[model samples]
Target chain A: MTTSTRVSARRLTKRFGDFTAVDGIDFEVRAGEVFGFLGPNGAGKSSTMRMVGATSDRSGGELSVLGLDPSHHGTQIRSRLGVVPQEDNLDLELSVSDNLYVYGRYFGLPRRQLRGRIAELLEFAQLSERAADKVDNLSGGMKRRLTIARGLINEPELVLLDEPTTGLDPQARHLLWDRLYSLKQDGVTLVLTTHYMDEAEQLCDRLVVMDKGRIIAAGSPRELVDRYVTKEVVELRFPAGQARRAAPRTDGLARRVEVIADRLLLYTDDGDATAEHVASSTLQPVSTLVRRASLEDVFLSLTGRQLDD
Target chain B: MLPTPFRPLSYFWVSFRRTWMSTLSASFFTPLLYLASLGVGLGSLVGHGQRLASLGGEDYLSFVAPALFAGTAMQVAIGQATYEVWGACNPWSGAYRSMQASPISTGQIMAGHMAWIAARALLACALYLAVSAAFGAVKSPEAVAGLAVGPLTGLAFAAPLAAYSVRARHDQPFSLVFRLLMLPLFLFSGTFFPVSQLPVGLRYLAYALPLWHAVELSRSLYAGTFEPLAGSGHVVYLAAVAGAGLLVARRSYEARLSR
Candidate 1:
């Protein structure tokens, strides 16, 4: 493993009896980068993250975290790694600050130093005012922030977050994204798993699109969009049920044509050229929208299925 | 001496501080009330001479104090070990999973919980013993020797219960332990009376339990007599149960938490 590689897995596999959760998959996470596992609910993203966190042992494959084999140096590897699970497991009985203090103590950090560290983490999570409140009393966003703060109490080298914003409002999601971005700025390597294309597009520098139990595609959001989809897409709406009938008229106008629901999508190298042809053609449409291709289109083009189901 | 690297006791200390009031009254006061109502109030009706002879020339309060200490140890240990393991392992709390993600090993987490239980059991026993003394139930200076029985009795239940608790998918399994196993052991384990007075078959059944061994050992200590072979037998029995329980618990915690 290279010094820059924080996590490296070769043909990593996990099986529960006969049902495989994670098939043979190869991936690597480097230092100071936001790496994401973008997949649906059952795509085995969390299973992979658990193995990398050194909490779950892989059934087969060579896996290393921070240049140490997890099977042999699990505790040593975990000492340098931090994990925020999909669920909030903060001590519901303790105050917000106590949660950080107790979690820091689990890392064997001295009590004298943890006081200042907890204060700093509380500030970073924007939860300084609610430090003394019970964890249960806080809102969903505050609890999530506190959980992340607890994960950072030991000042880890790499942090693994599993769906950090799964059930949060838009404002809460943005606030959490800000905190994570600041952590990335401080050079904390992040490995997160989420099914949200927008989140992956917004946060990840590199990501892998997984389906079933395998990674079907891996690249930056821009790279995957460029590799899998055309440069632009023209959305044509032909009032009510005429979209399916209008799709045939645009067969030769665009590189690829697809009719989904009430709209027909025309994928082309140049959307303006495609739109000009549609305007002058025999086809009659109500409205048209032209936009750049995105990861959502990439997922559909590669899998023939939508990412959000 | 310096604390161990993880200092698992701190987990229990912090948790205890938050609920010490309830823990104190519930675990610490139950034994005192039992001594007052059963050992004193009921002892008044049994009459000193007849009861003394029947209890082997000892007052009802003195004879039952050590036995109750052993029983209380079993109660307190089981109470803490079972629920805490369940709570920590449950998906909602996932405390053990959180700890497993840290530098602490599964063994350390299990050990830390055990250490915390030991501290609570010891404190409860010490308080019970002190209250026993104030009740004028002190028969011999060796009465303090009953102190060891508390933790041993508690651990005898705690370790194996912790093992069971980790594997428990829900709270339903614990009720079988409470209704079927622990209650029978508490009622028939010689805590309230001498097992020698029990029926022949029931006496043999009582002899097979760890609490019975703990009670006899504590009684012997309070009575200021030394039966080396018998003492060794009781000690060996409790030590074996505790050892086996610890082994099973370690394996269970490892299997459950390290997955």
Candidate 2:
């Protein structure tokens, strides 16, 4: 009920016929923070985002966005909340500036104000030079940036981004992350969904891992990783078929040993000791690596499957 | 400031600004070409036949021009509504999906789409009327009323086609609608010949169509031969068809976009 809580959902549920897309989930996003929903495909992340965006109707439970119920106040809530869908829906026939202009008008913003706002947004998205260019002519990264810029046209207090940088290359993804960081600095509350573990670690201040329409874990990225996984991970990839056989030789040397495909991952506080211990054992591995544990490791530990799979 | 339902007009307005030159040329020349080829050229052959009396005792050129005006309105309106409405919901464009993210409701988006189609129909019909007038087809000042009749006929088709377009998963059905339904109505619905010339059952079928009512209403207006009862009947029929189609289209848009 407080003003600082931008979104609050208590046991929110969404069902499509016989299947439940978001099953009795609970989460809250505070103002001026980047919140994330991290899950693999079919994890119901986008479905939950749509419910919070006030576009899809919830079949059960209570939901409040910006202190308004979406069922009753969808138009009002949406007026103040910007949304960037998973797909870029820019008007490809219109100029970059006109796409922003037309979307601004949908909020009933005056034409005179929108003209200046469009210029500022285009500059913010780093697309000033392409103002008159058709959206069809822009590269994949440029189009994604333009979609983000268009969402900001209403000066919304809260923005919901669903998989913002799914298809972009590494360089473009970094540029987008910088823009998102700037938005956070401007005191805008952001709720985004991404299956990318690095993106969740780098951008999200707090996040929840969803799987099969339910939130299995929730916390800051570091907290989730620290609580669920060890401080360091030792990955041992044996020659093709020997990984499963070598798993027993590394028992009790670490907190946990997960045999994934051709690699045996040892979770331990001291990855170097674990790697050295494995080297001294009877097992002869093809490759060994020691690295800091990440959200991907945490997800794998929780779900028993890779995040990207 | 525009109302909530009309806010989407800004999108169409910007689009029209870019393509209006080509649209205008098409609108101006399409009627001109039809009138020149069918009305003037074909009229010369039909004028010497006994079919002249059945065309309400008017010249063949004048008789066919008014029907073409109403027919062109139907074509323009259907053309505007089909691909644009389909593309709005399709993945490539997703224009409706984008608008659904804003404050605009699905009903408002449908209203804006229908309004834009009506506007285009009005513009195209007005041009068709101008071409008919230039060829000495218009009989009286009352013929100006055909302008309203033209767009109404267009809406009669556009609204229902838009309803179908919103839910269409592919473009195959649209081609069927055009080839199977639209072409038959355009050719046989009393545009070029009198409905009385057809066999009894086929004549009744033509009379049941929206285009036939439009052609009849337009010819009456252009010839200054408006009948009190029949004129009211045609207007009511066309209005009802348009109003019913709009209702269905609004619901279809809501079902598709709000999901």
Q: What is the TM-score of chain A alone in each candidate?
A: 0.94, 0.98
Error of 1 at A89 (Å): 1.3
Residue pairs with backbone atoms closer than 3 Å in model 2 (clashes): none
Model 1 over residues A1-309: C-alpha lDDT tens digits? 788999999999998889899999999999999999998899999999989988888999889899999989987888898899999888787788877877887888888999999999999999999999988799999999998989998899999999999999999999999999999999999999998899999999999999888999999999999888899999888788888877777868888877776788889999998999899998878888999988878878877777878
Error of 1 at A236 (Å): 5.0
**TM-scores, all models, native as reference:** 0.94, 0.98
Which runs in model 1 stand beyond 4 Å of their true positions? Answer: A236-250, A258-264, A272-288, B1-5, B48-51
Query: Residue-wise lDDT of candidate 2 within A110-194, one digit each (tens)?
Result: 9899999999998999999999999999999999999999999999999999999999999999999999999999999999999
Q: B102-130, model 2: which lDDT tens digit per residue?
A: 99998889989888988899999888888
Which docking band does candidate 2 fall into? medium
lDDT of 2 at A229: 99
For each candidate, the alpha-carbon lDDT, in order, equals: 0.85, 0.91
| Backbone clash numbers for all candidates listed | 0, 0
Instruction: Give RMSD to native, each candidate.
Output: 2.4, 1.3
